[model samples]
Target: MLKEFTIQTPSEGFVTITKQVAQIVEQCHGEKRLCHVFVPHTTAGVTINENADPDVVKDMLLALNHMVPDLAYQHGEGNSPAHVKASLVGSSVSVPIVNGTLYLGTWQGIYFCEFDGPRQRKFCVNIL
Candidate 1:
């Protein structure tokens, strides 16, 4: 099954979407399944990471900003850093679903990564 979800993001930040994905996964009727989440924007992506503490998200964004600092770039859009960040984060993530539950670590969760935003975004989740 495939579903689309719309979300609003800050100019740059991570939005946790674990519960949303789990809600969909909960509907699946099998014990063995896989959930694929994808963001279809060049400047956005998806990932799974520590979710127990909010600081982890902050630290990640900070590290990314430091690692891909803005500088002179040939990209006309001037979002070269966003593009690079998105590439580093990737556009999709897959989570194993077992016994109708997301098989993530206790502190792991799904997140929508917005490198350049303060706008609406869409992500799709496919369960199989």
Candidate 2:
């Protein structure tokens, strides 16, 4: 099964979409399956990381900026850093669905990593 949802992001940051994914998993009729969450955007991506502390997200963004500063890119759009960050973060995440629940770690959650946003984005969830 497949489902899609939209999210509005800030200039750059992480948005937790774990709950939305869990809701979709729950609707799969309590089957044990694998869920693939995909973000089909060049400047955005998805990942699994710590959700209990905001500092982790902040540190990750800081590190990415340091590694791929916006002003240091050859791309004319000036958003090459976003593309690099998205590539590093990846565009999809797979989680195990068991008994209608997502089998994520206690402190781990799914995140939409928006490197250059302030725009509307969509992610698709595929259950198999």
Candidate 3:
């Protein structure tokens, strides 16, 4: 089964959507499968990271900006740097589903990467 979700990011930051995925798992109703989450946009991505601390997200953004500064990009598009960063990070994540639950670390959460702006984005979850 595959599902697509719409997310509205208020700003350029990490937005955790673990709960949404969990709900999707619940709706699967005892099916054991592998879950793949994918983001189709070049300026966006997905990851599993520490959810307990807000500072981690801040540090990540700061570090990425330091590594790939917007001014340094030559693609000319305002979001060219964002596309590069997303490529480095990636656009998909896979998780094991057992007993209808996602297997994740205690501190780990699924996040949608929004590097460009406050816009609507789509996250896809596929179970197989």
The models' CA-based lDDT, in order, is: 0.94, 0.93, 0.88
- Local error of candidate 2 at 53, Å? 0.7
Assess every candidate by TM-score.
0.98, 0.95, 0.93
lDDT of 3 by residue, 67-96 (tens): 887575567777888888899879999999
Number of the top-ranking candidate, with lDDT as the measure:
1
- Segments in model 1 whose C-alpha atoms lie over 4 Å from true places: none
Cα lDDT tens digits for candidate 1, 1-128: 99999999999999999999999999887699999999999999999999999999999999999999879999998899999999999999999989989999998999999998898999999998
Task: Flag clash pairs in model 2.
Answer: none
- Specify the highest-TM-score model's number: 1
- Full ranking by lDDT: 1, 2, 3
- Please provide, for model 2 over 6-32, each residue's C-alpha lDDT reduced to its tens digit, 9 standing for 90 to 100: 999999999999999998998887668
